[model samples]
Target: MEKQFSGQNQKKLGLSQFVQAIEASRTLAITTKVTELRRQGKTIIDLGAGEPDFPTPAPVCDAGIQAIRNGKTKYTHNAGILELREKIAAFVNKYGGQYQPEQILVSAGAKQSIFNALLAVCDPDDEVLVISPYWTSYPQQVKMARATPVFLQASERDHYKVTAEQLSKAITPKTKLLMFNSPSNPTGATYTKDELAAIADVVAQHDIYLLSDEIYMQLVYDGLEPVSMAMFPQIRSQLILVNGLSKSHAMTGWRVGYLAAELPIVKAAAKVQSHSTSNITSISQYAAVAAFELAETELQKMRTTFAERRDFVTQRLRSMPGVSLSLPQGAFYVYPNFSQYFGKKYQQKTLNAALDIADFLIDAAGVAVVPGEAFGSNENIRISYANSMENLAIAMDQIEVALKKLQ
Candidate 1:
């Protein structure tokens, strides 16, 4: 039986309408569904989330617990603990950028740091240029800020890189920021220094800001050195580099990420964070300090393992009949081009979209992968190999069999 709402109650609930763009956006939906299915006893192999499958390193967790025991749970400085700000400044400086403690704004996660940057920099009706295959949140966050997100498609033929020539074409007077992610989430593409310098030259000449999300910088593979946009002298004035301990230290649940920028941008981000989700978690801030100060050896081990998995998964994807993947220098995803599978039939149902292929894999192959639509592509899908070797092997086997079944 359904409970009926009173007329007055109905009117109250309907007063605030949801904006359609915000309501329709989804990428976390698949991960939530997979978790729900597992809770109901279904054996699902999830490659849908961009999270690590490893536990947070022991030392970081211990520090958090110790902070609580030592009664350090009070509210912290709005910008973050001074020590953390200093540590972050030092870390950012090592990347060939100059940063003072005043230029660091700590937020709940790297996701929030990105939002803070958009909020601080973009205005209503302003244009923000984002390259294709972006993190799903960029457009949605821009919409929430009442800004327009302009997308430029980066083709796989060019290794999915956005050239300075292409960027010059995308810019207009209204373009306030140009956003790109190296070691991108879904495609795992890392831009070369020369490529970045070229793009930086374009943005620098235009008087626009460059938003570089380097959250996966530490996970780079096969001798690829990830370069920061701030390293370019011309771009440093307008660059906001977002990074966190999430992937590098396996500290996703800790919710510690910081934005490194000039003093004005950082101050604005801190002010916004103050009224929204202030200070992050006091205990987690302490843990983050340890994450930044710890030795590099353990982190290197994680990177080595991810590199092996990347190679393994890329080779497996290539073996599939119609699937093709480019080798990525960083991140643990293989975005396989599956346009050849479109217009075919699977169980008498026509496959038309990347979402369709993803659903087929999950429902028929028992493997969960993110659709390319989540990353602004309709001809591809992302496969994450952050699981155990045995599980990744089994999932790949099932995926190949499932693709062959499509007519």
Candidate 2:
């Protein structure tokens, strides 16, 4: 009976082999688990996810409401409405780059924008070079495209910024694209203009595209300006810039992200968007337009608050024994080195890997932090400081108490 049922199902329905290939990807699964635990009435203070805790600004919400009342619910264009594309092009041009509306493709979110770029450029057996301690999704997305992910290991010693020499050594004939994320997730490392220029010079020698994920560009701290790869004319032809209102305007639920590239690449990405997810919400596009037009003041307020939070959290981590951290120049995250406690025992239990430490923190301290292993490092942990000051203070105090029991 079992063999007959299996045979019938196997003949009628077949799952794609690629579906099984992605089972081990960690971000979505772990985040969902944490959310479920919280839903079950656990006292969980999640420092794991990378979303801002702020609400979308009132003006942006008002714009979306108005758009809905004015009958803007129907899909306008597959690539995005022309008005939004023009706004995006103008926004990109503000950063010393030339982009037309024809060169923009808006999608559901920055994640989808990245997926479109990778799918458009990658072929089977190609290599996608990613700098480590990167966002956890890069390698997964590369593998989904049937491309191999090559890690150029960056570390806390160098502030987690990959060097030109490192990238040069990693590139080969199979290398088709390099994924670069500044104000990086899990590590909070940002590259300077000079560093980007150096990397761009080497990429110019090879036939490689640079997928620059600049979602965190608006969150830079300490008077630092965010640099885009489009600023370099030498590598302009090979750069695809991805950004969105999800991070910058706290519009995560609204799901408005856009990619800026050459016309050919934009056309390819738009076709992918049309077939997969056609046109981000019409109301959301209006919301994004209002966000880009009128939320500059609110954006600055959010930036100031995040900078203070980053300072407070880094200071608290530094005060802990055997914990070391670099002052993240951008992004609202603190990636602290806790390698010294790996082999130590806490409460009769020996700590071994970062997952052990994460579990300990959650169970004993009531705080949730993502292990660096998920970001290609086992010696550190990422704590997002996007929560309120009071919560952050309490969480850090609890973390300190929990660490003292370790050794």
Candidate 3:
């Protein structure tokens, strides 16, 4: 048999192990399925999206148009255009942090900025501590960097937030970085200043890097302000603050995000970005400057709308039978524990995991949602409230009815 091997018997090529280790985004997969169903004339209430339901601010859009008209559509500095970087520096400094233009690197989006920073800091076999119920991309990005991702589950009883003691115990000699997201994506848990300071003390003591993803910092509710890790001078040098216009200004498609770190780290990330995606779109960079400089009023209005939606969604979820959830402090998501119905059956199918419930909802209720298993928990499902009040109300009604049918 060995002697008879030929071209037809040769093994097929496959993707790299790094690429193979990570799964395709579950959120995007559900969204695509929902789109297909809608195209077939089905009315699907999609709550799987992570983007704001608002339009980009008028001033930011106008700036992009002006940039294009002025022939500003040329290659920019690999770290982004200078004016944008300067604006980013000033903005970060305003929040009680010290940053310079040279310390800022602008990439395609906050996701890219975080990925680039991970690649720049992580080496083979390095370990990244990721908080559970995290953004779907964090662990994937760590894997893409050829590093190991170690998860530490934040206390669900404490609103899915990691504490300083928990973080301190999780550290090992192999730990290279910690991924922290405030107003977290799936859970919408925000850290207070005291909590951040305590965690920052641990990072400082360990001398490890911290990647603070603050994309949702602007959407905090109840007059709560987000505290930056960079605001803590003791750990300032070890912090990489990643933020962008995607969330705050409803410019998700614009692809303008930046990171503030030490100069050397910024340079390293810039090199990585240069070899990958040289620079962000020129028009988007110009538009981002206007977003930072002139869109506060519009951004505030959007935040207010999101707060109202958050309250509405939380109230409805709490009132539903067999559903349990904590009120989100920020961000646009409500992750409800749906394990109460795990043993229930519908139409000869038994619902066991969060994915099963999600699939059942899509098939029977025509409501699309991302399952909690995608975020490292199988007992819950994530519902994004970044939709119209009317659509959300209707979706809640449909969900309640669909759940009641499971007996």
The Cα local distance difference test for each model comes to 0.87, 0.87, 0.90
Positional deviation of 403 in candidate 2, in angstroms? Answer: 0.7
Q: Which ranges of candidate 3 are over 4 A from the true structure?
A: 1-12
**Sort by TM-score, top down from the best:** 3, 1, 2
Off by over 4 Å in 2: 1-15
Kindly give the stretch of ten consecutive residues in candidate 2 with the minimal lDDT sum.
3-12
Model 2: residue 164 alpha-carbon error in angstroms: 1.4
lDDT of 2 by residue, 135-224 (tens): 888988899878989999987889988888888889999999999988888777878888889988988888999999989888898888
Report residue 176 deviation for candidate 2 (angstroms): 0.2
Q: Pick the candidate with the highest TM-score.
A: 3
Candidate 1 residue spans exceeding 4 A from truth: 1-12, 15-18, 23-25
TM-score of 3: 0.96
TM-score of 2: 0.95
Model 1 vs. true fold: TM = 0.95
TM-score of every candidate relative to the true structure: 0.95, 0.95, 0.96
